[model samples]
Target: MDKHHSKYQITQLSAGEEYSIELYPKDEVVKAKYIGQGKLEGFGNQHLFISEGKDKNYIAMNDYWLRKKDDGILTYAPISSFSTLRINKSGLGEMLDSENVHYKNLGLRIIRFLESFGEKFD
Candidate 1:
């Protein structure tokens, strides 16, 4: 098993409810999607991200190759500015590398996780 394979619990925050942030093995192909309303909402092929870690190379990366199916694909709005953001009352620790697109991959995973909750609510 991968070192990061342990199951995690999502914490609730002012921004949104935290859901488990678990990473699947590269062999697994998890479907990603946006949380929408009504019949218009459902799961769809999407991307996911993996944090490269901090230090010399300050940027997370997408473990899998993600390609848009078509112009019809859905793109969720960017969440936090940083790939690994932990918002607390003390202050915000956000590291947004505007020149880097790896952060966007993190967004996709968040969106997918959110959609899972939406299904339960509905």
Candidate 2:
């Protein structure tokens, strides 16, 4: 794990590997598969994509930024700021970061999903 964010660690995903992800707050968990890393457009940054049926979402390997708000809420800026996040090899993750209410709620949902799989976050 990165020293600055010892609580978070990222396990690289393999192509075609299937996993579960919590994409929305209070929503049912969805099945997802690693699609691979690449850029959608010539000028875009390289990123990894996961497919949940017909829906595809990108996970930015780098440039995933986050911070804590004054009210102790977590906030994140996907491609703009800094923080640490890791999804373990067993498909578990811990994120101590996000501020916008929507993103904060979404983060909590993800944490709950990971907890369901036996992962815990501080």
Candidate 3:
């Protein structure tokens, strides 16, 4: 858990795979579709950025493109920047260096902790 990424809620979509801003809305797969990829910007604390089966057309501080699959394949990107981002193994339930976590309720953190699920919404 790093200082920068741990501040926001990470929408971990997959267990073994890592998704980064570099490969998200601007990836080759996305650009191949529209000959351009949308940009994510001008937002902060963008939580639950994108849901399953939905299109990624908006930018937020904390957001996701979409649930790629039921196997947890979500990618996360930090807002407030217009530069390249480093790909790391940050996830939803990762503790923030084990010190700053006291700021957030431990119980709530546990409640928010989920291993995996088939559906992305109700």
Candidate 4:
């Protein structure tokens, strides 16, 4: 995902890594790598995502109940369960290598994931 802007270089994403996405607008959107499966607690302003377990501190990103709209928008909603998903690392790598890549939702997800993993494109 190595993206180069006028003054900053974009972070690079790797294959098969789990990440967290921010629900708000900010310079940094992705939260963390998601060490283990986290449980959603509270609601609205009291909502909190907690990651903790005996053997695992967190779970994979896909395992979280995420809602994707018909317009290709993804967001977290009130769901009973979350499913395990897979990321296309090779395809993502190819997109990063090309100059035709559009850094929209998917691109941003990859960038944030890389940033969480401490990858520096700068």
Name the top TM-score candidate: 2
Per-candidate TM-scores read 0.20, 0.33, 0.19, 0.26
Q: Put down candidate 4 lDDT per residue, 21-67, tens digits, no spaces.
A: 43433322333343322232211111122222332122233433444
Worst 10 residues of 4 by lDDT: 41-50
Ranking of all candidate structures by their lDDT, best first = 2, 4, 3, 1
Off by over 4 Å in 1: 1-99, 119-122
If candidate 1 were superposed on the true structure by all CA atoms, what would the RMSD be?
A: 15.8
| Cα lDDT of model 2 by residue, 6-62, tens digit | 433334456677655433234334455545444322223332434434333333333
Tell me the lDDT of model 4 at 26: 36
Query: What count of clashes does model 1 give?
Result: 3
lDDT of each: 0.25, 0.39, 0.29, 0.35
Judging by lDDT, tell me the better candidate of 1 and 3.
Answer: 3
How big is the RMSD of model 4?
17.3
lDDT winner, 2 or 4: 2
Pairs of residues at least 3 apart in sequence or in different chains that clash in candidate 2: 9-86, 65-81, 74-98, 74-99, 75-98, 75-99, 76-98
Report the error of model 3 at residue 93, Å.
Answer: 2.7
Better of 1 and 2 by lDDT: 2
TM-score-superior candidate, 1 or 4: 4
TM-score of 2: 0.33
**Candidate 3 lDDT, tens digit per residue, 1-122?**
55445544544343333243324444522111111122323322232222112342212223342222233333333422333222112322344334555523432232232112121211
Clashing pairs in 3: 13-72, 13-73, 13-74, 14-72, 46-62, 49-63
Please state the error at residue 13 of candidate 4 in Å: 23
Q: Between prediction 1 and prediction 4, which has the larger lDDT?
A: 4
- 10 residues in a row with least lDDT, candidate 3: 28-37
In terms of lDDT, the poorest run of 10 residues in model 1 is 55-64
